[model samples]
Target: MNDTPGWASPGSAPSDGPDGKGQDSTGQNGDAQGAAPQDAVGQGPQWSKEQPPPAQWSAPSGSPGSSGSSGPGQTPPPPPPAPGQGWGGQAPGQGGWGQGPGGPGYGGWGAPPQGGGWGQGGWGGPPAAAKPGVIPLRPLGVGEILDGAVSTMRTYWRTVLGISLTVAVVTELLVVLLQGFFLNDSATTAALDDPDATPREVLNALGGLFIGTGVVLVVTLLGTIIATALLTTVTSRAVLGTSVTTGEAWRDARPQVLRLLGLTLLLPLIVAAVVFVGTVPGILVAVLGSSDGGIALAIIGGIAGFVVAIWLMIRFSLASPALMLEKQTIRKAMGRSSKLVRGSWWRVFGIQILATIITNIVSSIILIPFTFIAAAISGDGVGLLDSTGDSGWAFLIISGLGSVIGSTLTFPITAGVTVLLYIDQRIRREALDLELARAAGLQGYGTAPGATPGG
Candidate 1:
């Protein structure tokens, strides 16, 4: 009778239980190699050549099948050789192990052939990794990560869409109201375009433009931050094949929202500071000397700074997810992001840009028709451009509806990609898949003590 754990697939050397050995024909336990058999001196009854059915193969001495020992002079067959182990040798890959075409220990009686034959491409390899969630518990491919994000959105549409739509509608409403009340004035644009306008008129126009743009930017940024936080929770839960309610997501994410906001705000500042520093020398040169030369130098410096800013942005792209998932402070989050991004900067940047492109494409597809419809309804196509400030409430409302729809659909994609990317990175670098599998309660990957789930 075989005495191996059910979970221990055939051919794998049983690491525990039953002393990891079976009695030979002489009824004596020995190394798992094809060495000379011992004489039947002090040995018990020998095993028969004919083996029992697979059903009787069970694990260890204390296990059920161990009771099927031979009585008196009767003999019982030995259990099958361990997977990846030879007739009486070590598992493949260790030195001094049996040799065969498939690395070591490729040819043992009843041992599955190495490379291909049994479960998961032959029992030579470890069992296939478990996948309790959207992705397999291993390093992910580019397509896998992207697919995982889409899967999260599809599987948890209720919670994901609810969070997205609420944030989108609220933010779009605020923007539409702001534009309808304070920003759609034609005076600001007209004055700026009028060369003969006095200094005060131009100043007023510029001031109004900056103020309107700033307000709109701040509102949009806030909306994005909130959506990202909520969806980060959702995507994370999806990884464990668990669903989360919008309220649960919010409750989990709320505590870290402020820190996320600070991190979000700080990254832009850091980028701007880099750009400003890069352009500073040119500014000084222009002030003290030739304007042409200064302008040229400033342009060059600005480009360099812009390049650096992009690098920094990609480097820190993961901070929001890190902060939300790890319950980390802004500084620690940024540092964590930096650490994860190291040696993978180009990959992170490429994925982020790809996600951005996909979202933008989707947004454009949803928004263009609404824009045309808004222009037609308002009877002022030019008014749709903020410069005219003549876009009526009808135009604002229609366009804002489009904005909401676009944001609602696109928000999950962006946030899911970022969070999944963060997870992919950790799985590659930290073997997080093991933790994830355990957390998901996979059969073989039992929870380690003190081990927590999620990032």
Candidate 2:
């Protein structure tokens, strides 16, 4: 036997058992070879005798095993390692011999090998960026808002009805009592026309009428402010699904009364001032002009007045709600409301204008017939046909009754739209829907108050 390992001969068989290192003439290992050879230095048919064939290793063609005698278990020996390289450095899925980070060796196959950090094909990629101006409106419809108002009234009908009726009745009663005892219009014009009337006498009578009317107006103004503030408070609480007693609503709104009154007074005064200011130049131009110039000046004044009116209306539209709900000072509340409506001026204007028209039409339809009946029953309807007209009491009674009826019928729609508009703007600008949802007892999906969404 050759002193060299039995692997020297290309035709030598591998071992099958413990210590026998050589192949027999038939190219088969003796039963004494331990196991199949695995390491490259142990190659040869005798090496094979020490080790069973690799389970699935296949030999390349044109190698030493090209002979037909090689069994399927036999495979060609792997190529030698490269210089300065180790067994583990080979790239995956290449042949059994190549250079790699670890050194020359068989490499695994699949995805590229990753470094240890997150970005190196790992699980911690950068988060997605948020898109802008993509916030969605809550699922609210006009009918739903209207229904909420009706529901609120149903829930607190006593307070709303009582306050509203009290205002209407008191307003009408005072108007009647004033017209009856104080400024009788028919007698005033007769007194004004009297030839014997002195200037001082005339001035005294005029002052009395002015003071009486002013007192009535102040009473009406107070009633309006109190009623509106309370109504707004209840409406806001109701829409938010929160409970509000009449007393609580009234109490909460008490501190805001002066602010709201100032707002109410200031808004109209500002509008009137604008109209007065804008019309001054136009009126002067008209007074000093020919027909064409006068027409032009009048047209200019009208346009300016219209624009200022719309601006004032939009500016103060949310002021009352701001006062009642936010308890903001008059100037600050107006500023805040103006800020809230900055980008949505047109929408707010349109909704308010539409609501106003609808409320007016509905109120008119309900009250007009009553007004005619009151007029006819009080003789103003017949006095229009009679030349000796004494319809002062008749006119007062009819107008007072009409106003009371009209205000009662229109109160809910007006108050509802105002509160809804305030809430809508907050929803749009502040993401108030989530807060509302949470307030309504919804969970898992609703937003918390003052918590920024998707931050």
Superposed model 1: Cα runs more than 4 Å off: 1-127, 380-389, 446-455
lDDT at 102, model 2: 16
Candidate 2 is scored at a TM of 0.60
Return the TM-score for each candidate structure: 0.73, 0.60
Most accurate candidate by TM-score: 1
lDDT of 2 by residue, 1-455 (tens): 23231112211222112442222223232111212222334343332335444544454333233222236634433323333322222233422322212111224221222332223333254322211111122534556556656676777677777667776788768767766666565555555678898888688768776887887887778777777888887777776556677788779888888888888888878887777776677667777866667667767887798698878779779988887887888888888889878988887888788888888898788778876776666663454432133445665666677888777756766887788778778876886666665666556433222223422
Candidate 1 accuracy as TM-score: 0.73
Shift in Å, residue 331, candidate 1? 0.5
